[model samples]
Target: MQNVTIVICNYNYGRFLAKAIDSALEQDYPATQVLVIDDGSTDGSREIIESYGGRVKALYKQNGGQVSAYNDAVNMLETEFVILLDSDDLLYGHAVSNVMRVFESGNFVKVQFRLDVIDPAGKPSGTYVPHSAAPSDCGSPLRQGWLYPSPPASGNAYRTSALKKIFPVPEADINRYGADFYAIYGVALLGAVATIPESLGAYRVHRTENSGIDFANSESNDKAPKALTKRWAILRQMARARLGIELPLSFHDFSLEKAHFCSAVYQAPFTKRWRWVSRQSHSYFRSIVGNPFWSYKKKIGTLALSSLCLLPFSALSDFAVRYIANPLARRRF
Candidate 1:
């Protein structure tokens, strides 16, 4: 392992803070430094962090959000690689050792791996496979750039030099929430990125985990416009800085996302296909229908309207899904 530094950026996650730090420090790989950048936590996090004493390097700052944490922590360390571990997540024991195996490659900014999805109690519920292939089993030489099911923050180990282009991430409204998108896309823009085929970390699913525009669903309310505005700003930055194209972005529409998913379901065999329909139907139910983000009326209205996609009529199904579900989803956003 090449003198890796795990920057466990945290905020108000005192409940799981120590576990995150311990996982990093307990890695079998030697020469691993654990740096906890606490963003003005009020939940007794300071005490737990302080308990580690000099065993872990700690930094305290006002509630400036995640971008600041990474921006500050990266500048403070000169290590070759930095893992941005979330305070609520855990690094699999072999994470550092696993990621380092592929570091010697050239023209790559980072290596993204898989993470296990765990419950709040820390029991593994399911594996977060970035693709059907395993992390170690994935990533051919030419496989790079904008990987699908994008790797979670914890599963990534970034080349510090490559990060120089991404840091001080925009300082915009959206970036204030977190820098994962900017960092990942920015690095992808800087150079090629690879993937590992192992589940190297844990991503927690809890209420505290559900905020920001990424999780924006039916409940987002008027804030959706703000989120979208910031999103456009971030997208503009990525396009200009990375692609050198004068293009900007907007929430043009997501009818295509729904259309593509529905189209795939339409082509599958009925037995297998219903599963796809049910999954997305339930997804609409959960993300919009049962979503806490939506208003009671909007939730019911969206659900009642989107359910038309399940009708036996194909044209009606396609029209309802392509036009109704997606438009309602955006309005709910």
Candidate 2:
């Protein structure tokens, strides 16, 4: 059997830590190794990690954020394949086995699967992430500057060799919160990414402030677009340096374009909000038309939805902000 490791990174999530660890330990695959990295949690998270004792290998470090934890884990892991599980999420019993099977079947650098969304109480929210299925081969779309569907960190399993080529990513604040963006995009440049259409894990949604689950949080709304833009630029630079692949400077994803539109609508000065909204709306329209992977039906539907951006700031725009533009809101229902 091939060896696989699940690295669970945690900060102050003591309330939800045990369940995440148990999920890793209970995987049906015998060769699975569970490693938990506690990034200086002050909320009794240390005791919970210590209780695992011999079953898991634990590393305790100061709070250097998520990228730091990933950096530390990659430096020490010798497993052939690796999965990074957030401290608040979970892996199904067969997740490791399924991922290993796919890895054995092809020369893929990454394997991505769907995630069921659950509320804080562990109740099903009747939703799954990515909203759209990922394509088996992403190179064509990627070359066209289109970002194919992908889930958050916990939903991906990567080849350790490919990860080593991409890791030790710059420990900046942007990367600290969005390491998965670098991992997913970076590895895609190295080789193909396999897609498993079924749900293999659970992603918990809650109002943890920094979790970015609450749509009403103005700070999160304001920072999301700017952060996404920065991450894209960083990935472009990393691809050139690490893989010698020069990606296009322009990129488009409908969901992210919508985010920029909503942010401009709410954050721009009152006197200039319309101009910002119009610019973002045009960008959103271009993304819909240019996307090669989307069907005509999907493109038409999204175009109709994008039309709502033209309305002035009122009840209709408010509706667009909540239902049409907010990714979290769209994911929830």
Candidate 3:
């Protein structure tokens, strides 16, 4: 049996951290270790973790953010794989067993499971979204991007070796908004990824959740949209330098892929805030020209959208992003 190290970072999620840790410790999988990094939390979170006693290897550190905690915890892993579980979430009963099978098979480089959004009290809100694949049948790489279908990196599992090869984690900035997206993108560019069909966990959502708030202002709603705009730029560059290609015209058309689709994240109300629209258009054009498949029609449309994107409301394709486009991406794998 291979060893698995589960790293959970908690800031002030005192209400939920205990349950999350308890669930991890109770995994049916064998040869597992749990590491809980409390990032200078003052909200009695430390006390609750301490209650876990020797069950988990608990580390105390200043508030360097989640990535910092991840960086620190990963260094202590002698295990074969690392599972980054959020402090506010709960793993499904068989999540450990399922992940262990994939790691032990030695064929799968990474695996992401379906996720359900739960409320603060840990109850389902009647919004049960199935993952793209079931454990028995892993989905396509492109479909993996639609797993979370949201901004980035909330519900996914990775091989420690592959993760280390791409990123050591605890990255320098600690301020990265879509850090998980960057990590997942790096993994996709470098290694093969598999999708587990079963819903592996509940991604808790609430006003006070670490992810639901803006890290900088800590109170603004713009944090997510701002992070996404930056991610779009990064992906464009990665596609050019690494893949030697650009995002497809199909990628943009999919943005408005009628009645419903994922790329619509670009449509947040704040998405049309001018700053993001300008930058996204800049990246989109660069991608269109760089993509070999971009036809004359696409070139013309890209130019048209670019011009229209600059205007408010009338040219507001961003609206398509928020309402129609983003739903498919909430858990983008």
Best by lDDT: 2
Tens digit of per-residue lDDT, candidate 1, span 1-333 = 479999999999999999999999999889899899999999999999999989999999999877778788878877988899999999988888877877875545788888776667897754463433322312221122112335667878888987876676656445576467566655655566677777888888553211211222112323544553564467556557755633334322222233334444432444444566566544334445333223687656656655554556665445444333222222322
Which residue ranges in model 2 land beyond 4 Å of their true spot? 207-219, 265-279, 309-317, 326-333
User: In candidate 2, what are the lDDT values of residues 1-333, reduced to their tens digit?
Assistant: 988999999999999999999999999999999999999999999999899899999999999887789889888898979999999999999999999999999999999999888878888766687667667778667766788888888999999999999888888865676777778877877788998889999998774342232332113656766777887888888888988888889788876776666656543344455676455467767777887768898888766765554565454545555565434555544
- In candidate 2, residue 128 scores what lDDT? 81
Candidate 2 clashes between residue pairs 3 or more apart in a chain or in different chains: none
Of the pair 2 and 3, which is ahead by TM-score?
Answer: 2
Q: Could you arrange the candidates by TM-score from highest to lowest?
A: 2, 1, 3
TM-score for each predicted model, relative to the true structure: 0.67, 0.88, 0.65
So what's the TM-score on candidate 1? 0.67
RMSD per prediction, one decimal? Answer: 10.8, 3.3, 8.4
Point out the worst 10-residue segment of candidate 1 by lDDT. Answer: 209-218
Error of 1 at 122 (Å): 0.9
Model 3 / residue 107 / CA error / Å? 1.9
What is candidate 3's lDDT per residue for 1-333, written digit by digit as tens? 778888887888888888889888988887778899888999999889888888899899998776677666666667767777878887876787887777567566567666676767887644333312323222232323322232124356777765665444324463433456555655555456666655677776555322221111122344444444455455556555655645432232222122121122233344444655455444445444543334677556555644443455632545333322223223322
Clashes (candidate 2) = 0
